[model samples]
Target: MNVFEVTLQPASLKNIVIIGCSGAIGKALVEALISRFPDASIYGFSRTASFHSLEKKPDKYQEARIDYEDEASIAKCAALAAETGPLDLVIVATGILHQGEITPEKSLRDLSAEKMMALYQANCITPSLLAKHFIPELNKGSTSVFAALSARVGSISDNALGGWYAYRASKSALNMVIKNAGIETARRNKSAIIVGLHPGTVDSDLSKPFQANVPAGKLFRPLDSANYLLQTLLQLTPNQTGKCFAWDGQEIAP
Candidate 1:
């Protein structure tokens, strides 16, 4: 679909939703968005949001529960958020690198079906399910965005010293999901931008284990990455949908 065919509406952040909001990047996005769009109706979803907290939340900001494994719950949460109005922004800031003792495989021999499935479930299935339910909630006339966190290693062409097989593969598949979702969403809402964002090596729990390998000065705090990503999203045009971009706004090679 040609984006030029439709008159682009101004970027809207009136209604916002943050999936996996309990995580570091997710939480930072919540704060950044709140500061940037004070009047926006922000919704946060996590698997562990307390019921009492949700009940006490103000009308402008609410928290709910969303289990990546449970499609029904994801649907319910999306429905609840849309009750007020269609969502202008939805960010799935969830991804899995390691859980407890489980870490990314360092070699081909280290691969296991169990480990691979778990990685796929977190890095791929969760975001795909979110897009499945949330894409429909995107504003049609305005320039809305459905962005999920992706990694740079996901680029098959960029893989040189490959080791993390499942992690890389899961993100690659997630990128494809973003692409397909972008095409379909563009057909309905040409002004909507569906893309994936690589938030860089953050100081979050997800990257804590691998921090040693990161170059000094390259590691970023969660809020720093959040600001960069937010800025990147703000600069995106409808024609650039379906691609993955780094925190600096540079598109990752396909």
Candidate 2:
């Protein structure tokens, strides 16, 4: 079935949590969720405590502060969110591509142990940690999703030209984490779906420096990507758990 044809039943999505609610895609996802699931209680967690800087403030949802680098902060935020009752969906929208002096490596000579570790921390460990703490809170007998923002470059089988050593390796590791988590979650909550999502070349700070090379119709705005992703997500079933999917709903090979 075409993903776009899938309609989410609002009654099934009663509570939601977004881990990186301050990011461009995260903010757009929040807005889309609010519009689509008006009665759902949406909770947002970001590094920033205030929503004053967001282009669209989350006036209808609750917000909290969190730090992906800190395990304590993540645990506290997850616990607070759990208090609202069983979570129907949890999306980890946090990821880093380039920071300050650290950029994608062009060759082995450009790779550094420090930079590689930093990339793994952001792209791999953070989402794994989120699953570690949040998966148990998902509804036991109902359908639930624990999704992390991954990338197309993370697919080893799809890598025709390899240059982004650190970013690629980190996302690959993230894909593995999602797959492993999905297997375990299924054993407990048969309806829980854990997967990685590639948002395509979105128009965000993460893709800003790389957009020049993106094809004309490839670079999607945050709202469009968010809408597409949510549609893809709504169509997923338990049998499709542990897979990585692009925004268009195509499965990506690990």
Candidate 3:
């Protein structure tokens, strides 16, 4: 039977939170979830003043105002969402690519301390902080997933091709935090799986420029990447916690 003909459906995951919901992948994932799990309630967060920033219409989800940079804001958002009951899934889709004042210089001669610190704050610190505050809201006795969008460039062993110094380093650090948290979370909540996912080179503002070097068949649209990611998440066993995988469902060694 063809893959689609096999009734590819996600197991019942009732409550989900998608951070950075206005972004391409987040929007796509939310749309897919709304269609696949009509009874499921999703909470989507975005810095944008309104949910209009997303291409998909909000169905069962409530658009939450969030600022990834502020701990108080994230805490408030998490608290409100948790009031609905135990969270089945928490996806930290937040990440930063480039900011003149926050990212490392392209050349060695232009390196600046300010830029390095900013990148660390946005890419590495923010997600780790979110895990600190949000993972506890998940149901303890049942299977739950906590996943963050990390990059393949983050893999120290896979950095044969190098250039994005700040982006690469920040994502690498984020992976470590996720791995460490996964260990502790497993001990605390055996049913929870914490994952670091690399969504591949999707056609978004964050990855468009880099796609020139990516082979034609390798580049993914946001919808395709999101669907594959959701499928992978569903297939994960509790033992897969702390593991990093590409959107293609291939393991990415730390």
TM-score of each: 0.93, 0.93, 0.91
Using TM-score as the measure, name the better of candidate 2 and candidate 3. 2
In candidate 2, which residue ranges exceed 4 Å CA deviation? 1-8, 50-60
lDDT of 3 by residue, 1-254 (tens): 32212211256478889998888888888887787787888999889875644455556778878887789998998898788788888898888787545543466766667767777888889999899888989777578888999989899998886777888888999999988988898888877888899998888888765678889688888889999998888777767788888887788978
Give the lowest summed-lDDT range of ten residues in model 1: 49-58
Candidate 3 regions with alpha-carbon error over 4 angstroms = 1-9, 53-59, 100-106
lDDT, each prediction: 0.87, 0.88, 0.82
What residue pairs clash in candidate 3, if any at all?
none
Cα RMSD for candidates in order: 2.9, 3.1, 4.5
CA lDDT, candidate 3, residue 212: 86
What TM-score would candidate 1 get against the native? Answer: 0.93
Candidate 1 lDDT:
0.87
Model 2, CA-based lDDT:
0.88
Cα-based lDDT at residue 103, candidate 3: 42
